[model samples]
Target: MNIATRTLLVATAALTGLAGTALPAASSTTGAPTTASNSCPVKAWGYRGHYMCGTKLKAGYIDWNRDGRTDEVFVIAPNRHIWHTWKNAGGWKEMPGRGRADDMVGDNGTGSRSRCIIVYVIKKGYRYYQNCHYNGRWHNWTTSG
Candidate 1:
């Protein structure tokens, strides 16, 4: 075969191998739970550890905070409990009040997965919050005006 053709084949092979390696990382997002319990079902309101709060939480898309744009939420769960934090137009803020904001129990044979537990706050004019869980911790984010 021509040198150019062989070189093209080698480059294609290298690219194919690289692409294959990346697929696993992409699929890893759907893998097992990192720190939180995979079997915990999210409840609307329940006991999350010592703190009573909301459950079955899911992170929402990023949006404007009164001041301007902000970073996304980040969460971590080491084991039973989840910890959350976020960056806002104002700055970084940890969730207020100590305690679990939400709780979850394993779901029955309904074929549904465990629910997410999260905490949030709403003021007179402001409404709603965003949240996410990653690396064994929970993150809560919101916009304020």
Candidate 2:
């Protein structure tokens, strides 16, 4: 278990959960990792937060609200979990969840490309769960491991 191996394992755990789940991992083309948001306009999300990566090295972005624009950013912190965010009328809002973000996909409104945010959570290499915010409420990420 050298550093590279650990990094790969941790990155894999962050991308796909260690158990039963079926969502194709999104592709990230942001080749080099950015150190900090230093300039992300979104308030609650950028540069630093609970989910901000301290070291390891993994990240992604998505358009949580569809609007044909990217409004959410996720970072896989050294702790191996997903820190996330999105926007609303009030301001920026954090998508509430714990554990590494295994996989994330947009709810394409039955294939119309109307996007919504959904996150799959993985913990301890076995526990698995998912959550999403829709119709104005935070659904608890219940464990089904």
Candidate 3:
């Protein structure tokens, strides 16, 4: 092929490849990937160092790594479960899981640089139980009796 035709074909192929792959849209505020869908109910909230999800049945942030700093923002998904979205070097990512996070406090000494996550979960009938995320994973439920 001629130089001009070859260049055009290469450009077309590049464009086609991009079109076939879905790119994560970026946010103007944090420049992170806007991977959380519209189904997430807490996009308007901006994490202000620390926030507690409380009485109003609202949304807040969780220090999943327990660095005593805001790490991920929690939102109630359309499925009625809580999901966390956080940004790293790779941009924003949604933490996958089930159930509502009713409350959380302290790191419980489960991590190196951060506090462990001590979360209270709501399981059927407005009941909540405490659980700890230690050593990079969640321990079994400690039901509130």
Q: Quick one: best TM-score, which candidate?
A: 2
What is the TM-score (0 to 1) of candidate 3? 0.37
Clashing residue pairs, backbone N/CA/C < 3 A, model 3: 66-114, 66-115, 67-114, 67-115, 107-115, 107-116
lDDT agreement with native, every candidate? 0.28, 0.42, 0.39
lDDT of 1 at 85: 29
Model 3 ranges with Cα > 4 A deviation:
1-41, 44-59, 63-69, 89-97, 100-125, 140-142
Q: Summarize candidate 3's per-residue lDDT along 37-141 as a digit string, tens digits.
A: 232223423421112223222324555555777655544332223334455523233333333343443234444543333344343343443444446664444
User: Estimated TM-score per prediction?
Assistant: 0.22, 0.40, 0.37
Model 3, CA-based lDDT: 0.39
Give stretches of model 1 more than 4 Å off: 1-36, 39-57, 60-62, 66-70, 74-82, 85-96, 103-145
User: 1-145 in candidate 1: lDDT tens per residue?
Assistant: 7899957754554333212211111112222123322333221112121111234333311222323442232222222133332342232122322222122221111212321333332223323333333445533433212
Query: Which prediction has the highest lDDT against the true structure?
Result: 2
Error of 1 at 12 (Å): 58
Model 2 TM-score, 2 decimals: 0.40
**Could you tell me which 10 consecutive residues in candidate 3 have the lowest summed lDDT?**
47-56
